[model samples]
Target chain A: MSAPLVIIAVAIAVAFVLALWSRAHKRMDLEQWAVAGRGFGALFVFLLLAGEIYTTFTFLGGSGWAYGTGGPAAYILAYGAVAYVLSYFLLPPIWRYAKARNLLSQPDFFTAQFDSRLLGALVAIVGVIALVPYLQSQMTGLGLIVQMASYGRLPEAWAIAIAMLVLALYVTLSGVHGTAWTAVLKDLAILAVVVAVGILLPARVGGLHAMFTSIAHLRPGFLQLGAKGMGVPWFISTVALTGLGFYMWPHAFGAVYTAKNERVFRRNATFLPLYQLILLFVFFAGFAAILIVPGLKNSNLALLAAVEHVFPAWAVGVIGGAGVLTAMVPGSLMLMTAGTLVAENLYRPLRPNAGAGEVQTVARVVVWLVAAVTFLFSIHSNAAIVALLLMGYNFVTQFFPSVFLCVWRRAWVTLPGAACGILVGVLLVAYFALTDHTIVAGLNSGFIALAANFVVTLLVSAATRSWDMRRTALRAADIPVHRAGEYDA
Target chain B: MSIRALALIPVLCIFVGVVFANRTYPIVLGMPFLFFYMVVCIVFTSLVMAIVYACDPANRKEE
Candidate 1:
């Protein structure tokens, strides 16, 4: 085996062992497996949330956008910081509700709050649909990284299959604990590699200053948002839409339930933006690639190609290992969350009498099942799944209005209203995504869909709301909405 | 101003300010003007949140 392949093999082995090590002496009950028994301290919660930020997408696509689309790439940085700000208020109520109710999955939040199992099932189906494509994307990204870093010594198919097996093994054995432990390794490795490449790659051509200067000379106005397609309006709307929708993903939403206390979120909100600055280095790597390795048809390969150009085989292996961990950490979390959603929300509602042990068994089985399906899609290169992945963010964003409403003192929207609203939002997203009109009238199609969803939800709630809801509303109004002492414990 | 309202400053700087800052000329700190502005806004977001966290009574340690 080549030196790079050997190093990658060792890294994957270490990550797998660490994932199993996290399961030492702990019971893998359904609660423990799904949300780490809601016992993670501030540090673990911080790492888990931060782990969501630097996925295979950020590792490659962030830089890819910088190479191909230029100024539009900065939206990645803008959305996360804004999302953190929103989370400071949004997540505390959610964590409190989930903690009180012992909720395990995102759909549980909808089910409990709205008193509708149908809504829960709807969300479960949507979450699983949105998540499978996401998982396949991670697998696809891992395949690309291993194939490139190994100099084609390792085929993408074998690489994906190996990763899927390891991910399934650890996720089934160790659950969310496995994801958290592996996240520790992933964050450190990606941080080191991003900083190293972000700095050294630029120095090869010139310094950061000289590199941007050269890019400006090569592609004038590349650093600014364009006047037509990706103009200022598109930039603003896309950033707002993504920022609002960041935490709505089922995995991200479910991750909040693992926090030990509400204050963990407040603290995370404070420092997470500082952590987001790491992407600046990622963009630096992409910009450096533009000047160093020009004329790459596949812009996603920009970062890996640049690394291969400048570094030795062993260095490429190290980066590839980091890349693989990036895929595995999130991929495991996604698979676990999807499984729990199916078993807990979808199957449990149907069986009703299923014991906790039975649910855990079903969840584990579903994890492997999802892993197998996404693996097949990744290898087959299914056109439909690829298209679904394109609108995955928009699909998840449809949940935001209902989530925001559900967390209110007494949710105003009735269950029918919430269900109908989400259905409309999702249908609009499907229409826009299928028609290939992601931007309509210079605004993100998702943003427009969300606005329409909000209007329809309100109108329907106003029509469908009954007398009991009004009574509840009146009682809720008597209590102050923002009680400073309520969450202090 | 309420601490929650104070949070809106970072939101505005990111969502609204990016429009006017979309220029490539006169690179600051080796970054294009737009990128430099975003980096500053990202740093500013943390600082603002830090202030919010410190001032909010709900975050105070209880006896």
Candidate 2:
């Protein structure tokens, strides 16, 4: 019933075969399954990153958000541009360690940076937990698209159930290569749909003038810069959460770190913003739909409504197919990252000498396990993945305070300082997010949490005064001096 | 120039163009000028990418 069983079957079948082929042929060992053997170059990395960015959130949720929030919807495009530029400054140092140490997760970087395995594990645990809601969000989105594609013939829960089964089977079989190949098709389809709609939607809206006049008449604030209903504080804080939180996604870090060279990454870091062409068009399409579907409640379906209004059934099918593939591609990548982090950082540490082949097998096994549980979670009627993602933002960001002040800034810094910083950061974020929040509206709770973290680090550092930043940070980065394994710190 | 001014130019350009189109014309191509500005943002983003890739020494390598 969901996605015209034929369409769902076709998509599921294609995703499954692709995953199996990659697992059988492309995956040679743990590195290949986890990081595609560190061989992604210009086109490959571009496509993979493309798949990463265009999620179900973009396909269905972008227009939906706009339709739902009106003026505030511009945040999608607004934050995206900001996120990439901000990450440019942040990603290089991360890449340096990932390359040298074969790091597979963000927690790995934290461990290597501070020379504290416990700190590394804390980040790893928080990241994995945070991803649970994100994964569920993707599942919910997949269900919505599948239902839309089915022409609303299937109920939402059933649609979600079917898509989950197919996604789970395909991802478990294929590994990262499976996701990359499918992403190429996924990205191509998204571009074609976005470009076609971008040119057509404005025409259907009775010219841009009428649309503007209407927005002014009915939803004046839709044109407002402040987006007062949500306010500047929420927007700025949400954008900060997205910008900083994006690079911290262990999946993205793992993928970018797997790039062939710093040049490719820097190119990607700067150039990937170029690919945001479709996102810009999407923001427009979301705005366009507002005039036509004034009574519509769901903002996520604005793109679909815009498509149905401007185009016909067959074209709509193609767009729906693109949405499903978007989920499959990135959802698979998340699984790969989650699996690798579990197997390599958490599992391998316990076993230490597990063979590459065994580690690879463990990663594959974990993928199936994680996918199954996430699918079950997705079937529920009212789970909050978006909020959970913000929660993840709070948790993952705890690393930043210690990262900036304690670990990289000085050598011989006491581990207690770093631990206290992370602890306070997490506690402040938790208190602000859940309890009688302290930080006033404009600033995000995460920012407040970070402030707490930074303050704690300074206090502890002053108390210790026993560490030298230069000596420790250099050693933490593992820059080879005279010997391969010898470290100065 | 201050960093603030350097950042303000492009942001201001976006606002000016968006305001001009919204006030002056009908939505062309089923979109308003602000919608079109988004396209401009996307294209401008690409141009920025091309420049960075071409100029950044870190991006180029010996074959």
Candidate 3:
């Protein structure tokens, strides 16, 4: 076999082995499938959250943004660190609440807290919409990696189809456990590749200092944010919007639910920033790429292009394997989250009498369904990875106000008020995104919409004085129940 | 102030103050000032969180 073929085969084999291994010593149930029975300790939760956060977007898209846009890409680094700080305070209470109530998903939190199945269904709908693009972008990145790694010998579409199939099968079988096991391998591969390429490429073209000097010479505003483009205001606003919105992703919230305890969740939050330091190396790789390989049409290919230029075929294969996992691990988790949202929150609530077996059956079916849809969508996708991420973030961030308020304990934000606020916030986000209009100077359009959401939520809550909802929320917060076994089918 | 509240001071500073260190002057360890500043904020965040965890009542209860 050729060099690319050898590399691709080795990487795929490792990923398959990891996936199959994750299913070992685990029972098949909704609790096991959805949230891993809420038994994950700090280290497992840390790796799982790391896997969920640093997707193909971080590997390909982070480098891609650094290569394509230059300074604005700094926002990528800023947001994760800020989100970690937020999570320190945000997650423990949530874990406490979730573990107490046996809440399996983000929508379950909303449903039980507000006593509104409609609210739960609404969250499910919005979450599915937000997550599909995220899922598709990973497919897009995987397609690019496979096609590029194979020296264009393999078609992008076929690569995506195979990845989608593999992702769906593992997710249907092992759920979060499978994603976590693959993550351990994926994270190791990514850290090694990112550090090696980050240092190697820069040294090849002189040194880190020399590479930046040359990039500064070629592209004057490349190393720092310029007054003319992506100014301080834009950077600050984007970081803030993204930071606040970070854990609002339903899949991320689901990961938080998997933590063994409040203390474990808190510790993971405290330590996650260390994991984020890996992106700096990724940025270095992108900075190196601009000088080493120029005139690439798709900026997303910057890392691959640089690797191909600098590394041997064998090393490139290793990085390619890592790259494929970066996409697949997160892609499978997304399929699981979106699938659970549809079956558990959307259908189960409506049916009201569905057995656990029936619910699990629906979830498995939906997993395949989601993968197929994302597969078809990504085949025709033209959006860049960074653009897809930001677009998804814009919509998902609208949930921040409602979720934060729900967790804060003192806030009496009513169910109807939350419903209205979410509708308005989502509409504003859609309108601004569709029009490509800058509603406020120096700020992300999403931030403006989020502010509007908070204001609307506060006003509606105060006006109606939702005393009954307040009582419901307070009661919901206090349910410190022991972990219950799986609901009988 | 309590340790929990104190921990947020640096986080507020990083988000509101240090983020504007956007200028490329005084590059430290091959990173721009803004980049260096962000890294500091991240490290600072970890430290503060460590402090909060140390002081947390939950830890005390376990002990």
Candidate 4:
């Protein structure tokens, strides 16, 4: 067998073993299946969190940006590091609330906190919309990885279909425990294979200084934070959008609730920035690409080209396999998180008596449905790395103002305000994305929309004082839960 | 699980960067030296994670 296929087969085998070992059968139990029985210690929490952060995009796309856009790609570093810090400040109280109320999903927190299922439904709807594209991005990357690594033996369509089906099966069969356990191996595999191969590339090439001067001479503006025509406007817009939007992702917030302690959340936030070394590496890959592989029609393949060049066949196969795994685990997590919102927040509420078995059955159905629809949607996409990222970040941040106000400020807003906030936010993003009118010189859409959302929500909320959901949530936070061992560890 | 483990990712990134920064190639696949260095960083990231797991106390518990 070719090295890529062999490496993949081994990874698949490891997934199977881990699924069986982590108690796939027992995962049908609500807590065990959905949230790993809420018993992850510091280590499991760390890995699970890391697995969620690391993705195929981080591998392929980050490099693409660094290569194509040069130093501006470092915006990823600025945002990622900022996100961890924000998540730290934003996540702890969320944990205290969720553990107290036995909440599993983001919508669960909203509905329970505000006693309004409509708000829950609104967040769920936005979440499903945002997450579907994310999962598709994962599958799309997986498809590319397979086709490239196999030297086109596996076509993109067949690769995506088969890889996604396996993801669906494992998620359906094993649930959260399976995701968490498989994540450990998947993440570790990526970390190991990428590092080993990364080191070998520069040695084969002339060396670091040679790579730098070539890029500097070829495009003098590339290394400058702002190209002359572009200047600070583009960089500021990107940083502003991503900095606020990253924490608003549902899977990330779900992790907040999964933390064993407030300190764990803080530790995770503080420490998470340090894992961003790969962003720097990815940025470097782009610079290195400037020298050796001067022009490829598709810049997305920079990392793959690097692998094929620097490593032997077997090692190349392993790296290729690792890239696909990077896609799969994140794809599974996105699929699972999307499904959880549908089943727990939507279906379970409408049918309160649905048994654990019924819930499992519904979650399974939702996964396949999301996968199928997303596969269709991703068919025509050729968004640049920065563009796809900007789209995802802006779309998810629509929920933030509503979420933050409901939890923290005791300022209950009107349904009109919430509705308008989402509507205005979507319209602004759409106008910017579709019309190319987003050129405010130094401002991004998220900053504009966030400012508008806060303004509208505040005005409408002040107008309708009695619907104030904040005080009610505040009253609810003081109610204590029965303590179990390692509760808030 | 120590800060040292996390710290290694940046240290190694800088090291890989120094290597790529020192390269003489003009443009590989339409990307710059910085771009080329990114893939190397990811591999560096993966390697650090793998060794970290092997040493992790809790990984043994799971096994």
Candidate 5:
């Protein structure tokens, strides 16, 4: 067996053991399985929050964009910094609300706050649909990493199947506990691998400055956004849209439920942006690849190709092992969130008599089912990793206005209004995707959809208020009038 | 001014500053001008959030 494949195998074994070990002697319940019983402190919460930043997407897609799209790739860095800034204000109220109501899933927040099971179910459906492509992207990234690292000895399909089986095993066995524990190891490995490759690869071409200069010299416009489609307007709109949408993903939104207190989020918001600097190294690795391994057909392979060009077989094995962890940790979290959303929001509402134990069982079963479905899609899919993630973001971002209103002190939006707004936003996103018109007049179609959603929500709520007030008055009049100071108690 | 409003600094830097910084010439710290600008914005985001954390009465509350 190749050294890299052997190393990857050992890494997977160790991660699996660590994941199972996290559940040692602990009882598993619906609450424990979903949000680690809402007891994680700042450090674990930080890891979970930062988990969004360093997925297989960052390891592969971030670099791939830098290698392929050049200047537009900086949008990844810009959006993340802005997101962290927003999270400072956004997450605390959410954490407080979730804790007070014991909400375990993202849809639980909507259901409880809006007082509508139908809205909750609609959200759960949208969350799962958005998550499928994201989960598929991670699985596809894992397959590509393993195949490349194994020197083609392990086919992409087999790699995805094996990794997914391991993911399902750990997630079902230990739940969110497994995802958090494995994230610690994944963070360390990714940090070391990214820094090493970012610095070492550039040295081969006379350092970072020389690397950029050579690329710029060869391709003058390579380091800047394109003139027509991906110009300044596209960059601004994408950055704004995605920054607002970053925490809307079901996994990211549900992660707030794991925190012990609101302070965990406040602390995380402060430090997470520093962690965003790591993407610079990811971009560095991609830029170095442009100099060393130019003209790669599938630019997603840029990071791996660059590593293979310079590093020895054993080093490649180490990088591959880290890459595998990057995929598995995030993939497991996504699976866990998708399963919980299905069980709690979708299934439980339909069968209101179901017990917590039964619901937990269903969630566990759904984890395996989701893993299998995404694995199939990952193998057959050819969409870019970043593009898939963006599509997911578009769908989930539609939840922003509803979520914002739910958290406000006043109930600014009625249930019907919230429902209609999300439905309109989601439908518009679908239309944009089907028509291949993501950029409308230099603005991201998702941003445009969000604007339309906001307008519709307010207009509907205003129109419904007077009608609702009159109905309440009529119902009040129909009731028997109470005597003034009845009984004088 | 409310300390919470300081958060807008990073937002504006990223969304607005990038327009002016999108150039290959005038490399700063061995990186393209745009990339360097992003790095600066990231560091500044941490600093701004830290200041807000220090000033906010919410964080001062006892756990």
Candidate 6:
């Protein structure tokens, strides 16, 4: 076997063994499998959240955008820092509510807050639909990394298939606990690879100044936004939308639920932006690639192509291993989150009397199912990885208004209002995305949809405000809404 | 300004100012000046977040 293949093999093997060993002696119940029993400290939570944040998106998409859009790639850096600020205030209330209410998933939070299983089911469906593209994109990145790492010997299809099977096995066996342990290794490898490639490539072509000077000469205004089409309005809107949607992902909620205390999350939010600086390295790699490896049809190939060109066999293997881990770590988390949604929210609500064990069993089965389906999509789908991810974020961001209302003390939003808001938001997203319009001069379609969602939710709530008029009184009366479909108080 | 409100400074400076300013000259540390300004904003953000954490009652509570 080639060095790249051998190194990749050893990395995957180590990840699996570490994942298994994380839960070797401990018994895992549904809670353990889902949220690691909500016992992770600040460091673990930081690592886990960081792991999920800097996925194939940062490893591949950051560089890809730096190569393709140039100035617009700055949104990636801006959004995370803004999101960390948002999260400082956002996640503590969420973590408190989830911990108090024993909510395992994002859908569970919706179900409990809104007192509607159908709403939970709707959330599950929307989340899974949104996440499939994300999962598929990860698989696509993995395939590309593997194919390039093996010097074109290993087929992309087989590489993705192998990754899918391995990911499914570990997720089924170790759950979130195992994923957390592997995150440490995955993060270390990512940091090393990104630093090496980000710095080395720039240094190769007469250093950073000479490289950008050359790029400016080659494609004038490539380094600045609005030069080639990344308008200011679009950049601001995309950054803001992405910042707001950062913590809306289902897996983000799951990771939040795993925090040991509210302080863990608050502390994490404070420091998470520093972690984002790693993408600066990734952006550097792309800037370097622009000058070094020109005329690549697929911008996504920028980083890997540059790696293959610059590094030796061993370094390529290690870098490829890191790239593959980037794919698998987040890919596995997405699969686990989507599967849990399927079994716990979608299936269980239909059969309200299903046991916890049954949900766990079904969730395990659904992990494999989700991975297989996404693997198929990755092989067959024509969507770019970045586009797929942005599409997912667009769909998921509609939940923001509902969540913002739910987490706050006022329970004014009726189930019908929330549902209608989501429907309108999703439809707007579809309209803009399908029509391929810029949503009125460079604003993100999702941002527009989100605003419409908020407006509709408020209007619908005002129109039907009397429906849940006594919700506050009902809560004050300490009545459980489960006793009655309407107002238990 | 309070630390919480001060946090918005980084967001505003990076997203709004940097985009509109759009200066490309004077590449600092091998990065475009605009991009380098973003890096400065990032470091400033971290420093601000540290202050936010230190001031937060929840983070200050003795375990």
Which structure among the candidates has the greatest DockQ?
5
Candidate 3: tens digits of C-alpha lDDT, residues A11-66: 77777776666567553333343345366565654544444446888888999888
True contacts kept of each: 0.82, 0.33, 0.48, 0.04, 0.75, 0.62
Point out the worst 10-residue segment of candidate 1 chain A by lDDT: A480-489
TM-score for all models, in order of appearance: 0.88, 0.78, 0.88, 0.77, 0.89, 0.89
CA lDDT for candidate 2? 0.63
Candidate topping lDDT: 5
Candidate 2 lDDT by residue in tens digits, A1-489: 433446645766776776666666644432343345265565665544454467776666665666666555554555565556555555666677678888767777767766666666676666676676677777877887777776777888788887677666666666545544565667767666666675567557865566666766776556533454455555556655665566667776666676665555445545666566556566657667887666765555677777767676667667777777877876777777777788777776667568998998888888778777887777754533344455667777666655544324654345667777877887777677668453356555776777677788778866765454654665657555523543222
The C-alpha stretches of model 6 lying farther than 4 A from their native spots are: A27-53, A408-412, A437-440, A470-489, B1-3, B56-63
A49-76, model 5: which lDDT tens digit per residue? 4444688888898888888888888889
Which candidate, 4 or 6, would have the higher lDDT against the true structure? 6
Give the alpha carbon lDDT tens digit for every residue of B2-55 in model 4: 632563454445433443453324455434544454444444544554454445
lDDT of each: 0.80, 0.63, 0.77, 0.65, 0.81, 0.79
In CAPRI terms, model 6 is classed as medium
TM-score of A-chain in each prediction? 0.86, 0.81, 0.87, 0.85, 0.88, 0.89
**Which segments of model 2 are wrong by more than 4 Å?**
A1-4, A26-52, A151-153, A207-209, A225-229, A305-311, A353-365, A372-391, A404-414, A430-440, A461-489, B1-63
| Fraction of native contacts, model 5 | 0.75
All candidates: DockQ: 0.75, 0.29, 0.56, 0.06, 0.79, 0.66
In candidate 5 the C-alpha lDDT for residue A390 amounts to 82
Output the lDDT of residue A105, model 1: 79
The alpha-carbon deviation from the true structure for residue A82 of candidate 3, after best TM-score superposition, in angstroms, is: 1.7
Tens-place lDDT per residue, model 4, A324-370, is: 77887778778888888888878876776789889877888998898
Q: Candidate 1 or 5, higher lDDT? A: 5
Span of ten consecutive residues with least summed lDDT in model 2 chain A: A480-489
